[model samples]
Target: MTKLTLYNNLKTVRAQQKLSQSKLAEKVGVSRQTISNIETGEFVPTARLALLLCLALNKKFEELFYF
Candidate 1:
């Protein structure tokens, strides 16, 4: 089986938007650690949360999440 490497530039995007992890997490209804984990590829968000993140970040889903 092949391990999937999901790479996301969440940190970069967040910085571009001038949003702190805690602020982004609050907007997405997740803990700051959760955002940190996601940024570091330690966790994958649900579709709903993904949508919320996209909406909050003003970025397309593709821009936020990618392989």
Candidate 2:
């Protein structure tokens, strides 16, 4: 199987929205470390979480999680 590469778009999206990691985490109902892990490519979100993130960031799912 092709290992999915988790890219760090959290920082960019947060910056664009003028929000902090904690703030975004609260909005997404996840821990700040979870956000950090996603941002650092240490964790891969589930399909639902990925969709939530895309919606929160006002970005496309592909844009947020794909290459």
Model 2, total clashes: 0
Each model's C-alpha lDDT? 0.91, 0.82
Error in Å for residue 16 of model 2 = 1.3
Instruction: Specify the highest-TM-score model's number.
Output: 1
Question: How many clashes does each candidate structure show, in the order listed?
Answer: 0, 0
lDDT string for model 1 (1-67, tens) is 9887777889999999999999999998999999999999999888898889999999999998888
The residue-by-residue lDDT of candidate 2 on 1-67, one tens digit each, is 8876666566787888998889889988999999888888888888888888888888987677665
Candidate 2: Cα lDDT at 6: 60
Off by over 4 Å in 2: none
Model 1: per-residue Cα lDDT at residue 18: 95
Compared to the true structure, candidate 2 yields what TM-score?
A: 0.84
